[model samples]
Target: MNILMAIHIGAGLLALPAGTIAVAVRKGGRLHARAGTAFFGSMVVLGITAAILGPFREPEPLSPVAPLFVLYFVTTSWVAARRRDGSTGRFEILACAAALGTSAVMYWGVVMDGATTPAGPGVIYVLASVCLLAGLLDLNAILRSPLTPARRIARHLWRMCFAFFIATGSFFIGQQDILPAAWRGSPALLLLGFAPFAVMAFWLARVRLGKRLRASLQALPERKLA
Candidate 1:
């Protein structure tokens, strides 16, 4: 358990800076690619370790399953970015099923034991909605087959950004006890924790609204435009 905790903490620490770099750097560049890779790797480790450690967190019964959300988003985003052809396969079906199942579980938890759930009913409902939406989107993508370049990029960007948001929120807000006393409850910390949403919005806008940018992205090779 101690080993899992250490690994989880270490992965979270690594993910913070790596995700920051990935978001800040110019997209499609070598630096961005490297940072994104590091972020993805760290997040995978972090999610796995967190899931392993969650059962021991006596007060947070939902802890064990929560990490699966991040894992799903990260894995799907990575797949979207790498698969230039935008093809969907059995993996998409499985992910969609998992997401819907997760949503069902969350809803059941809130309906059955809302008071004891650590996230409360509101947050759990919102999360469940997100899972439902994601599952629907996955179903759409699977049915559509061979998504357009813009759609592919949009999918990757949103999922990856959301995953980063989870990581940031978990650390800068959820783990405030590790910070200095002066930093606790600081507005700056709050902004930092939620910054990824802003960044994600910006990128999604650029990808969807900027016609020239879309053309450029489509023209670039997969290796160059992740």
Candidate 2:
């Protein structure tokens, strides 16, 4: 395993964080809107780069999963952004449900594979569901009240950030097959990516749930985030 390569790749992915922090610095400000464009642009660049080089660089399911995640992120991000008209339509609900259900299943899968993933995937799955449910409810509330508060938008921003964090972690773990067998169990070397793939799956589920949960909380009188 090229330890340097893994670190380099993971660190490079942090650009997404930079863009995210910028827009989420204070939701709804002109600067926030401007930074958001940059954040999306940066992610697009990262996704495209990963896609074009990912297949040759990494083999099997991991490579494909990366691109697929990118596509999902892009499409969903678009829906999340453009669908900001405050109306949660059938498509939105369908997409959220599918994403949430998938996360739930994935989490259960990891939990079943306890040998490799002791933490289980359900944690992530439930988290993603929370976000999704919250987002839906919040969207409805916003439609009625027509206001996306700073903290609320920041929570939304963090939800995506967390998702990206999980994806980046997966990229490292999924590449394990490429690592030297000796390096596989090297604590210092592999600690960061020891369970790369399962972690990603977990995060994917959590982030999606967070999306829904945020909506749910938004709609509630308490106005909290899950």
Candidate 3:
């Protein structure tokens, strides 16, 4: 248990910085790719460890399904990025099922059991809602098949950004006790915790709403023929 805790903490520490670097650097650049890869690796370890350790925590054990949420987002995002041809596969189907199942479990815990997560019911509700929405989006994409480049990029961007948000929130807000007493409950900490959402929104708009970006994405298929 101690060893698992150590590994989990270590992965979280690594993930926080790696995810920040991935978000900070220019997208599709070598630095961004390397940082994103590092972040993905660290998050996989963190998620696995957290899921395993959650059930054993003292006083009140955590719901293991929570960590799986991060895992689902990161994994699906990675797949979306890798499938440059905008193809869908069985994995997306499996991921959709996982997301829906997770949402159901979370909703049941909060509504039926009257259980609150460590961060409270509000966070759980938000997480559950996002999971449900993601699942629906997954189904839509699968049914639509061969997504547009812009849509695929949008999918990858939001999920990865959301995963980063989770990591940032866990560290900046959830672990505020590790900071100096003066910094505790500081507004700066709150901003840092939520900064990823701002970044995500900016990039999503760029991908989805920008005319130039849409044009470039549309040109991708034609360029391949030459």
Candidate ordering by TM-score (highest first): 1, 3, 2
Error of 2 at 52 (Å): 6.4
Please identify model 2 stretches exceeding 4 Å from their true place. 1-14, 17-24, 48-78, 104-155, 164-226
Per-model TM-score, in order, reads 0.89, 0.44, 0.89
| Cα displacement (Å) at residue 73, model 3 | 0.5
Clashes of each: 0, 33, 0
Q: How would you encode candidate 3's per-residue C-alpha lDDT over 50-101 as one tens digit per residue?
A: 9999888888887777688789989999999999999999999999998888
Pull out the clashing pairs in model 3: none
Candidate 2 lDDT tens digits, 1-226: 3553454365446644554455336646778666656555555555655655655653431233344444445445544555454344665555556555655655555566541223555554554465456446444544554424333343344444544554445544545566788766456544454333344345455555677888998988964698
Error of 2 at 104 (Å): 5.1
lDDT of 1 by residue, 99-209 (tens): 999889888888896633555468888889999999999999999989999899999999999999999999899989999999999999999999999999999998898
